[model samples]
Target: MDVFIFQLSEFAQLVFETTWLPLVIWTVISFGVWFFLQMFENVHPIYQYHTRLALIFSLPAGLLSLASIHYISDWITASAGDGLTMITVISPIDISFTQVEESSGIPFMVIVQSLAVAIFFSGMIFFLIRFCMHAINLKKLRKSLNYRPISEMTSLSPENRGLALATGKNVQVAFLNSEIIPVTFGFRKPVILLPDTLKSQPEKLNLALRHELTHITQHDFFSHLMVILTEAVFWFHPLVHRLKRELVEYREMRCDNIVLSEASVSRKEYASLLLELIPMPNLNKELSVNMAQESSNLKKRITMITQQSKTKPIPKQTSLILLGVIFISTALAMACTDMQTQNVFDEEELDLMTNIDKTGEQGFHEIIIYMSEEEQAERHESKLEQLRMLEPEHIESVHVWKGD
Candidate 1:
């Protein structure tokens, strides 16, 4: 048991140290790949498809990296040990698979099954919490927005003029009691709405309408719903938050481009109009409509538009080279599992009974005691109880070893 505990602890330490570099490399690669894919195009069909693929591949890549670490550790230990009997001790339990027929105590199948069950329960708890939060948010959004019916017609108010043109329908616009939110709700027959004050200014109303209509044309509400779900599912990853922010910005940029292209408005003119209608007093109320927030990025948006040119085409060879590099990196990471050795010990020849007092004196006193399994178990239990009684601040760690 003592030998097993020592070996298992060493194995865990080895795995952690060996895998740290590879894990860091993979994390950076994954983030960079995803970021570049996002920046290559605004929220278009191709960009969305690539983003989904990146997300799907990243999960398995992360899991595989972790598994490779464990596999490497186990392989090294097994190789080094050769044919000697080995056991692994995890707290009170000791697992030995070296001589399965003779020992008949703890089977390898039992350990694997137990681990699977624990993982299953942990995953269930995580998903349950995520689903509940999403359901609550959906209910709140439905209750907060009042839906008004609409049919075919021409522009009604200045606020919904852009929406009418974009949807190709004279949609009815509602004045929600809630401030500057212009949301489209309901299925089959959708309704668009704006704040009552927005109807006064023609310029402000036009800009607001363009923003909202962008939402309708792009089905941005549905995109937002998908983002929210992804965030809930991956609440633990900081990258998930980063991805959401990037997607929101891209969505807005795509819509802005569409609106500007159709209106044939130069960057300066559109930017001037955007600044004038900047929702100063009602900025807080406009949070729902302006997903990116009214910040300095407004200037960046104008710069992007002013500098926009035809996207440079990538050569097929360059694309192939990039893909090849990614594949090679992944292969190298996976290959690390194949080059490990195992651990070994000779129990009979070592004469554990005689070597009981052979502890080398260093900084601390070392003691070795020889005892039967029953006696050793009792001693271990006693020591554990004593350690528990000690104040956590005063106690460090206790190490135990066995004599043959």
Candidate 2:
């Protein structure tokens, strides 16, 4: 159990170290862009939405790149004769658990590190379980509601039917007898769940359909799923939650913008529709995009609908260039940070020792030593003698294990 916990701690430390720089870069880039957007006006909501989405997935990509670079650089250093070893040198010696404990019970840092990792994994599991529960609720909600295909609804006029078809062939729409607000969800088979009350009022129902269909057209459901997954993994980060909220706001605003651009309904009437739905209860919102989910964003959505400017849309090239700059800057920052951490190699050496320990047979005392492959090939015996001599005074017996 101790070994197991220690292994978990080591794994956690490695992951945290590998990801810390990228995570920091992500937060800085996300919040900096979000704050800038807050200060400005009329920066096309779709542009804002895409920007946040890119940042959402960038952190993981950056971490993978960083790991690849780190290992590749190490290999290049070894091949170029930069004094780094290519293979781990392992020489085992008899070192009893008693002697090891008496000399140093356990490093204080190791226990503390293990505790921290335990807490992190616990929180992650808790959030993951919550996400699963929400999914189950969504399943139940789908089954319990009395629903029928929107196509079968007699009240859908020709225009509304055309809009529904244009949304997508895979998109599913249903009018269900429920008190909850209209919501959009699903990935392969996207769904729009509308309240049955809208059946008697064709105009309001059409407006609701437009809003939910706009969500499907923009692929907000997939975005919502990705963001929720991110939130579950990074449940501890405040910036992650903030990112989620920002995406929600921007996507909804963008959806509203698209609906308004069609000019099928006046802004005043649309805003009034939003007002009527503002207080409706939301169900499984994290898994779905609930129209008018909260009061604060509801206020912003209404404000944008009523007061938006006819600003020229940002060119795609410009947006890509800006995103490229942010990504490049983040990479550079990570490189600089890595250069400053000289002890990272030592930590990796310790990891190799831990791995060697894992292979110890029961009832056998073992001491694992790490050396460069080059050193072992050249001055194997002399280096081995020197390392053995350098072994701690407390070690009474010595047995070395060498690999060919």
Candidate 3:
């Protein structure tokens, strides 16, 4: 148990040390993208949507890519006949919790790291539980749905004709008897639910269908799922929640754009439709895209719909800025990880690196342990002998042999 705790502590410390800086950098970059969009008077919603997603996903993707490359590069260098391998000499004080307690007690830093890991995991677990519960509730709701074919939906005007054809052939539609707002969800067989109230109003029903179908055709359900997962992982980051809000806002606007671009309704009519809609209680937000999800952003959505022309292609300046932010942030993160690999174990107090002879053969090393008169070397004789017999190919850190 002690060994397991020691190893866990070390792993936690390593992960924390390597990731904290990158996370900071990524957060700043994410905010930069967000703030940049806010600065513009009329950035396209699709552009905003894609950019935010890129920022959200870049951290994990960048970290995994860089960490893998760093590991592989180190492994290759260590395997070469003339490579200088890094050997992190672990001190007894670093790993021996019992011995440390017997002496000056467990290190404060170790305790803090353990607590941080515990807190992070606890929060993550809490969110994951919430996510699962919501999913189960959504599943129950799905089972209760009395679905009807899109063809069977109430009267469709000539302007809204063929809009249903644009959606996936297997898409299902239903009307909930409750007063809840419209929602679209599901993957293998996507489903859209409208309030029973809308059933009696054919014009509003057609407009609602256009909006929900935009979400269905764009696969926003999976995108919404990704946002939920990001929230779980980055639950502590305030900016994550902010980005989520921004995503929903832009996503709704983009759907509005698509619906308007189809020329089904005039800008004035769409704005009036948005104004008439009110926020209704949603059952499972994470599992479904509620049409009125952005009730708070309704004014902004209406303004965008009325003012903006047809959706614009991304501006070159916006694209360049996004690329620059991603490139620089990723480079800095990789540098930090590399530096941590090289210097993580080089402590001034332990003097672990002083024992290594760098002047020796390229792929070989000698680690000499100096003991005080109060300490007996004989206690570690077997361990020393074992270390002496090991070859470069057998060890992960590579090429360490004990010296007389």
Candidate 4:
């Protein structure tokens, strides 16, 4: 269990270090561009795409670049000549659970460092538990809902055929008892769940139906899960919310664009349907995108629909340039990150450390000797002989490494 917790903490630390810098860079770059372009119009749609791209790609890029950095660093450290052997250190871990020895006085800075690590692991564990709970609730929600075949809904106008054409696959429709949220669910056999109240209102139902279908066509559910997992993993970071907000806002806008492009559906009618479905006080599902949302988000959706911009997507060449710049910059940022301390000890070295009688020159020599991987195999044989022969004052100058 100790090993398990130690490994879990290490994984959390790896992801935390990997993500924060890239997340910050993504936020700054996205916000900077948003500010620059919005000097023309405050709600310029371009930021939506900028936000989308940043949220979508930055973390994965950061993770990849971070991994590359560790690999390269290891190779460089290992390939160093005979003068510098790759050493195995047994310093205090960032997420250390064991009490520090009385001889090693814990410093103020070490307390803060350890506290930060505790908070990180705590946040990751908390979100992981929350994610599982939501998953179980979603499972029950699916079972409780009544499902019907798409064929049963013949009231759909012929105009909806365009919407059907939009979804190349057959989609199932389900009815829920509560929640006005019309959302898309499932990836293989995609289903859209609507409020049972929409049954009598075919026109409004058709609008809602087409909107959900558009989400299915785009495979928004997977992206929704990806963003949720990202947020869950990095719940401690403030900018994650900004990235998530961009992702959610742009997703709806892009879907709205697709839904509008398919037919002659008036923007006003679409906006009205959205207003009609405004959620009462909460949302109940996860891993799904719904038609109705909170009022503030709804306002943005309405604005985008009513005054939908003529701005085109960032051009492919331009997008490539931007992506390339982010890629290089992210790699460079990972390079600048400070090297992390690692502690790996064999049983023999552990025995040396646990020796409570160890003090002064003899104890210190055993510790440094263990640090040199090449000399670790010698154990204490040569060191014991040298310790017995030499006086403490006769020893050469020692290099004492300061550890946090």
Candidate 5:
């Protein structure tokens, strides 16, 4: 169990350090862009595409990002140490740059400055490309959709009547006033507009209006928006996509729960209303309205509603214990698995060892040797004898070398 926990912790740490942070940042940025786009434009195809793209690219990009950090750190350290010092003969791999008050020819500062400038320029170019796509999509959405105030409608229209019945919360609904195609707009105020034909059915209109209103009252639209944004940001993560899908399904379920709670209508009646309002083939693709699409989830939603009475509740203590276990397990898994500090050496010892100039041109480098009892017995040599091997005449100097 300990070993398993340790391994799990290491894996968690690696994920957090490499993928999780990057994915989180990417999700935030992607969601921010999507939110802004939704405010101005109908959901852009590019936004969806970008979300999928981000999920696809997240893992590789995360690994690369981590690698880059290590590389940059090494590069920075190396570049900081330009040639102010001469090469004292030591290991062929060992190279050190020393600081001199005055030195000529390509200082470490210049090298680091050049590299920093290049990185900055590269980042700017990437940002420009990203911004351009967002700008283009926003421009197109503005052309397609026109915003109107929610309070303009005096009576509930057939299109919005269903929404009014479904939600108890006070909300406004509106539609984009466009002859080309109707787009649904939602936010603090939501709207659903219909063509002249759809407004005639009083019963169907009530059901449809109730459905849309349920979306607003339960904040289904916003929950979906959050999921979509999350999906976009985590485009590189399969788990994120799965989670987003689950979140959407849950949102629908919650909305259904609300509808069931308020209406007192039989399950069959509600289901029948949903089926009756299935728009014609031509109206299927309209973006403004949430539809009873996704047949698989629809069945599940119906089943859940039918079985709502059988739902069981777990004890509070059990829930708390489960949460605590998960938290502790996750923390332990991360701690044991972290690679960075796994082989940590004393920094002072490492610095002293690395900086030691072994060649005689610098000075005689003293190495203090400590031995285990077994090692001392195996060697079986006095300190004097060891000193004599280097220089017999310097034997007396050994005691002098020791501090008082």
Candidate 6:
């Protein structure tokens, strides 16, 4: 239960001081890929299949983040350390902008660690809310549906069923008695759900199935699932949105291309179908495609279909080149996972600091205090004041380990 409630990134950072570094590595990978790809005006067809290509290039970032949890910093005792002189500065938080020296790593760590934790928890919470909402919506919608058969489909069903069959999944087409727009739902035994409005205008059936079956062939439901998870994980990052938008548009275009390839389907009719469905209610189920429901992109999608935009099959060499670039860049970023950190302090300053222990019995501290059960049970707001009221002799020593 705690796993679902509390933030995990804090515990991860506590164990590995440099655990936040992986997020930096990921930001670089995401941004660099997006920037370079955006600069190319005519991206080859290999990359125009952007949905798969983007995930292939970007998902390894998760592995890098997972590896960061294990990054441990080994500490060395100030007395045993050599050469470095003690020049005590203020605490990390008090560090001024003028303190440009690389020796003051505290300020840098403070800012980076805080930002990383903030982003991590924020994204997690956002993703959780969205996930739960989708779950509830899917359950409600699925219950409202009554089972139906492929044999009962309209005249347009045969060609669409043939296309679905080519994907080698036994497809079921059903009538969803809801105001929700056309969608392809389910997995394993997938169902393409058409709004009952379609039952009246049977001619619209071919256009709808061709579009939905094209989605089936493209395996779009799985892709939507993957992107949503990625969005939840990388919610605070800008590139996550960019990647999402890119994937959504490209997958839809790819389906349009597939459907338009059929001689029987006319470009004007396909565009008309999109225009027809835009005003209806929209629905996005987890792992489902709501065809013609996106109002903002409706015009753009219609244009793409009507224009019959065509591109050449990418030469094998170009694909290899792009793949190699992404591979090398990702590998370099992953290597940063092993970066080590250490806390360094001057030996001379340490001697003056622990002057109370000349006998060297315990170099760190000579006094200790234990809180009474009643005191421990006090509210946290009053506990500190209670501790302050205690005399110096009763003060506690909180020994922090600086192990090497």
Best by lDDT: 2
Candidate 5 per-residue lDDT over residues 1-404, each given as its tens digit:
54444454555455444444444554554355445644753222223333333333343344455566657756875675532221111211322334545646454544554554445456556545554564465346545645444334444554454445445434543343322122233555565544333345544444445555656755545544544443444344556665455444444554555455554335666666544434422122222335454556667666665756632332335533543443343333333322343223222333343354433234344444332223332332343243335544322224223221
How far does residue 312 in candidate 3 sit from its true spot (Å)? 5.7
Runs off by more than 4 Å, candidate 6: 1-21, 40-46, 49-119, 151-154, 177-179, 285-287, 309-332, 339-404
Collision count for each candidate, in order = 12, 1, 0, 0, 21, 1
How well is each residue in 226-298 modelled by candidate 3, as lDDT tens digits? Answer: 7788789889888888878788878887787777776546677677777776557764766688776756788
Cα lDDT over the full model 6: 0.59
Rank all candidate structures by their TM-score, best first, as comma-separated numbers.
Answer: 3, 2, 4, 6, 1, 5
User: Which one is best on TM-score?
Assistant: 3
List all candidate RMSDs to the true structure. 14.8, 7.4, 9.3, 9.2, 15.3, 13.3
**What is the per-residue lDDT of model 2 for residues 205-253, given as tens digits with 9 covering 90 to 100?**
8888888877776677776877888777778889778778888887788
CA error at residue 178 for candidate 3, angstroms:
2.2
* Model 6 C-alpha lDDT per residue in residues 210-321, reported as the tens digit of each score: 8887777767787677677777866766766677776666566667766766667777777887888778776764446778546777787786666645424435466556
Candidate 4, residues 147-225, lDDT tens digits: the string is 8767567887776666666677777788767656787767767778887788888878888888888778767777677
- Runs in model 4 lying further than 4 Å from the true structure: 1-47, 72-105, 158-170, 177-179, 279-282, 307-404
Arranged by lDDT, best first = 2, 3, 4, 6, 1, 5
CA displacement after TM-score superposition, residue 77 of candidate 5 (Å): 20
Which ranges in model 2 have alpha carbons more than 4 Å from their true place? 67-104, 157-160, 309-404
lDDT of 1 by residue, 1-404 (tens): 64454455555556544444555555566677776775865434324433533443344455466577667767976676534334322222122224455665555554554544445456656766765665565347556655453333233444355455657644445665545434453323345666666666555556666666666655555545555555554455577667666655655565566566554444566666555444533322212335234445566666676776632232335433554556455545544533332111122212322232223211122223333344433424544354345444432345665554
Evaluated at residue 54, the lDDT of candidate 4 is 54
TM-score for each predicted model, relative to the true structure? 0.45, 0.73, 0.74, 0.65, 0.42, 0.62
Alpha carbon deviation, residue 210, candidate 5 (Å): 2.2
